[model samples]
Target: MEENQLNPDVDYTDMLSICSQALDFYQQHGITELIHAFNIANILGTNQFYAEAAFFYKVAFNMHSKSAGQFPLAHFLLMARLVALLKGNFPIKEDEMNQLKGLCIPLYNFVEGWKRYKENGDALSAIRLMGNCFEEFHTGEEADTIYLTIMMDLFNPNPEICIKDRTFGAADFNVIPNNLFMYWDQNPPAEILQNFEYHKGLTHFNLKIFDKAEAIEWLYQNYGVEARQIFLSARHPAEAADFLRVHVINYYGGWWLDADIKIQSIDKFCSIIPSSYEHVFLLTHNNVVHNDFFGSVPNSPILNDCMLSLYRNSYLHTGLFIAYKTGPGIFGRALNRTFYRSLRGETKKPSVVLLNDRKFWSVIADFETPYKDSTPHWQAS
Candidate 1:
């Protein structure tokens, strides 16, 4: 497993196959106490096979929760909670919830109390509990870093949607969002805009290319003072982009694309939108959800849920602030939760259309990450 992480040449498919076999062996032989499932989840997650990895993480986490102290365990269960949040397994079974509630025993209650805070809309107590989680599982600098990151996000969410339910619905346009919205912090070379202009969808009004100022204003109005300060003071403007990305889709409706996502692919489909039943257009690469290129009409319930789930996870899984609090991990978790809930008869309409990567991500652009330290990706995609 260390080799896989160190070596750049590892084949993810083969790694997953090996891990799956190990899981089978562990299950059949009843080597419960000795079993560790993080390796499997790690491999799958790295390769973008998040949904499957989430399923495994959930089972392993539950098993670990029920085990005696002899079971394989990490000093901090941050990763476990992260993948679980990404899985979006909400409204968990009564027994599962109980196990989670009791895990942070003696120090203080964990999930159970967090759930109460969420229900009551009490941010202060919730953040306090999250800080306690950091102290409980980590120490020294690691604990300090974890606590600070969660507190920053909690203090300044940089809310995405400034205006809700502005205009457009299925009746107004084939898709509720009437235009294609892609984000770029700096102005793109003329060519990108050219592609956008030429390939504009017939049903839409205009292509709105958002930059840092627009994103900042929208989020500031929606999320308020602390969020505005964070966006302005962020090391890189892109760190605040995901905050804006969620708000754009939630408020205006339409697609969001990484600058690297080719314009032609989305433009080609401009003539057509997903059927009325489909609420979102997402794609999975290597069996994991990849939203490098994705779309939603307007005011999608799952997008709101995804935003909410992120805060819910802040206290429990904020160790990897960039990945868990603000990356596709939570987005995938929210999306997975939406689909799972729908399967259980919680939602009526069909949600998410998984697309083909070969079609959308062809000719992958060579682009450098705008921000290296935080990897605050998709803040404005």
Candidate 2:
């Protein structure tokens, strides 16, 4: 029960133990009730076992939908079903699809649009259907974010392939330049510097390291006043770096790794990327596209979308959190827009690839410096 309570420090092993306990408790008590099924689903969802969570949610929904109640518990359960499926990237089954159609027309339409897009790489119908869901469904920001993520996933050209198919040798290279970039606000500590040099030696790529002043000067000279102003307005050094990295990569297409990243092996890293990809990113454990390290070709539409999002989020929500304002949240939104445009034939389908942590860790890792604890985290601030 203690494990079921919220604790950010809970590790994978702890999650497994909690799941085992919950399952055993259910089996021992012969609990086959609707709420019990939903409770198990919640446990699984909390542990990041989304597919299993989705199955149990489905079971709960079937039970709840059959009963009539004054409360909207059935509606809540149905929404959970949608969230679980989207997060897990699992397909909707026929019975579930039929139930969705009967309960909430707007959600059903959006899910059906997702289904169509997933089945065939067309986005026009999906886009059209998606237009009306927000006005009709009226879910809050959190649900909207999930819906947007689902749209992105449905339109992804290669949803499952991360790095395995990208085993191109030294002869082939991406349109993105061989240059590597990293930044620190001021004098980087010894450990970070060591990480910088290590990655440089590993890749043998032309490395461009920047301090705050240098970053500002580069932005001013290359992108003019608007970019320089946005960079200047950043609340944290991390926020400033976040804005600058996108501009740098979008202007001179190449790889951008955080100063703290250390590549494990150059050969393994190089072997995983296909030369044909215009852009590449890694999906974090929570399924959001990681912004800490990624690559792009110059003038990539997706990166451009990110830049636009930064500018808009900066001017509109000046006090917004860093992640949504200039980090992975904006990046994921950009992916959604680019994928939609690609589906509608409005632009060239982005040649983007997304890898998971398994392949990503096989290549590189976050090298924490001694100053990590002393540094001000956004969450702490």
Candidate 3:
């Protein structure tokens, strides 16, 4: 297995091999090799290897359980508990939630709100409480200095959740930037083909479909060695997607549509929403915008900052890095920092249009998780 790039969608055999290697290191060196196992587990979970994530979380916890209450390990332990919730391990095996007895406001609200959501389907309530906590302790960093994911999944609140003054029609241009364009052989995953068919009908799109090789070449030729290295170093397909998606936009400057978008309604969404803002366009019903689908002009500051933040946070193994750095979370954070900085006269104002939700969305992950049928914890409205 490669040092990076663990998640492969076509099959998990490769990842399973990598996990075994990580486990080997732990077995050979004992607790000193804990972080390797922990980081690999995180990579597996991000790629939806829930069963593996559960197993590794247990292993890591056992290795460092004694030090869990100490300074840095506590934070990781709390996060481990949260991740356990994602894969169906509930009411957490331990009696305590996190090791930090002296809690911070955001951390307290986050843990409590998550419990509420888990107990009853209260996503909005949990989100609202978290939002309030953030407002109470707003830290305006270029990146989302405060990183948290209710789950590694993106929380693009359904459009019906809130009314908006403006909505979207068709985007200025048709473009689709995604991973694994030709990575698969003749037989790809059924889900991959389904997503492709859903949007390929929109023939006019400037589709920039890519596989691992194509993406690496594009990065090397266009952006340079560093970007290619970053893309190649990702521990999973999603991580590669996370890194490459931003680079494609930063270099080409166009709409980045998920393969699962319903292409049939693109024109209507674009036409109805008049072009009021130019450089970048984002949509949302909730305060936090999602990365499912968004557009930006070439080389915009938003995409640039996003790329930079991803590079800076590459070392972090937390869910926040997966969410913000390699996921849709960074896009909004970068935009917020740019906009807020302009407000404070720190930078020039960017021409960005914020539209009502449903401008573009991928229903595959819209409001669902693996535990959808067995539980009622995260039902969509």
Best by TM-score: 2
Model 1 residue-pair collision total? 8
- TM-score to native of every candidate shown: 0.49, 0.65, 0.50
The global C-alpha lDDT for each of the candidates, from Candidate 1 onward, is 0.49, 0.71, 0.52
Model 1 regions lying over 4 Å from their true place: 1-174, 186-205, 226-238, 265-267, 271-278, 313-321, 362-381
lDDT of 1 by residue, 1-381 (tens): 121112223334443454565445434543233144555655555555655565446545544554456444531243444434434444435564445445545223444435545467565565545434542432222323323323323332331112223344545233645556666666655554554554464334456767777877877888777556655654344445555677777777776766544454433444233444335444343333444556776777767876675444444454444544555555655554454355446785344454444534442333443444444443333
Candidate 3 wrongly placed segments (more than 4 Å): 1-187, 272-274, 279-285, 315-321, 358-381
Model 3: per-residue Cα lDDT over 153-210, one tens digit each: 2232332332233445776533323211222212335565666664566554555567
Q: Per lDDT, what order, best first?
A: 2, 3, 1
For each candidate, how many residue pairs have backbone atoms clashing (under 3 Å)? 8, 0, 11
Which rank order by TM-score, best down to worst? 2, 3, 1
**Superposed Cα deviation of residue 153, candidate 3 (Å):** 26
RMSD of 1: 13.9
Query: Candidate 3, after superposition: displacement of residue 296 in Å?
Result: 0.7
